[model samples]
Target: MSTPHPHHFRPATTHADWTKTDQYHNKYLLSQDEALEFALKNTDANGIPLISVSAAQGKYLYLLAKTLGAKQILEVGTLGAYSTIWMAKALPEGGEIISLEVNPKHAKISTENIAHAGLSSKARVILGPALDSFPTLSPSPPFDLVFIDADKDNNGPYFAAARKLVRTGGVIVVDNVVRNGRVADDSLQTTDVVGVRKLLQMVKDDKGVEATTMSTVGDKGYDGFMYILVNEGI
Candidate 1:
């Protein structure tokens, strides 16, 4: 008999179950509050896609930034400014975050939301295609951390750009890298999958980055993220 493929195995928990359990635990551990709900409502009222990171995930980003003591952060997507508000709250005085958004409408709405969150001074939404806007960005002190949660089809290029923008010892996080575990299938070569694979290969080829991917199942489904730590002298 032939050996079974790893993908054939059943998961111990369903995505819905995991999301519910985790979110519940997160509320207890991380102190769930209303500010995030307010942001969601702001985006909803604006007719923006209800696709901002989940409450638990937003908290995770906030904690990560806080742990890094990040002074300059770069975020590639500012959907509802939900995540922006989370990270901005973690910033110390004089710390700032630049978030890139493609849609002018989205940028405007995000700016309003950021201001509503009382983070207008620390978070700024740059309006334009992230790929085009990246070149114009000249962080005075270089980004201490970078978060890419934009178009998955261009993850490879985004990763390249983020690598250049971030300083040594900085962190780079790429969201939705797993794409419901489609990344493991060689037969499936969708544009987003191809882009993710290309980025994985680039990380493998580049010695300067110490990277790893973690698979996650949440309310958004079976997507995951890539975490990278930039080594010195790159």
Candidate 2:
């Protein structure tokens, strides 16, 4: 085993920290609460405000889908289906995306949102435990790209699952890695942060992949960090 670089050990981005800063998360990451509510009408929540992903992350992933010429993609999380729209719309002609969510209400709303976006033909919304379903997932992954944004505790399992599903040259993008920069500090024991750090290590040790974590983009505010793991490059 190779020794890990000092910088690879960092914290995960906690959703809690993001919600604390009114201006940071509200105006930037998740900009359209009202529109999101309308778009994600029945997505497992109160409808006042939704748990959509950061705009920065959503746009980035969408661009990656186009850039990678991704035809088949899998996302671990589908909160209200807000992020699914960004990904599904980016799929190339005949391309497809399958998103998994545990919440039945959110799944129904997401299905509706995809239809509203006129992308039902290219997207599939599954309402069940992604963990159980992941092992049985077939057509043998080699998925062009995979995004991990679901439960924090399952991140390591998701990482292992990513290795199994993504193609040799594919990419896996894990979100919210730089939570409040508290991840950089060792004192914190938040589930996601700790889990993300461990996940980073697994990717770093795998000689078959190349990886890096990027902090937030638009604002100096901690938008989030992504660990881009690519197989076949190393």
Give a tens-digit lDDT track for model 1, residues 1-234. 999999999778887797898777876877755666788898999899998777778889999999999999999999999999899999999999999999999999999888888888899999999999999988878898899999888988988888888888899999989988898999998988988999999989889989999987778788899999999523
Error of 2 at 68 (Å): 0.3
| Deviating ranges (above 4 Å) for candidate 2 | 1-49, 217-221
Q: Cα deviation of 60 in candidate 2 (Å)? A: 1.4
Model 2 lowest lDDT segment of ten? 29-38
TM-score, per-candidate, Cα-based: 0.92, 0.77
Alpha-carbon lDDT of model 2 = 0.73
Off-target runs (Cα >4 Å) in candidate 1 are: 1-11
Q: Report the Cα lDDT for candidate 1.
A: 0.88
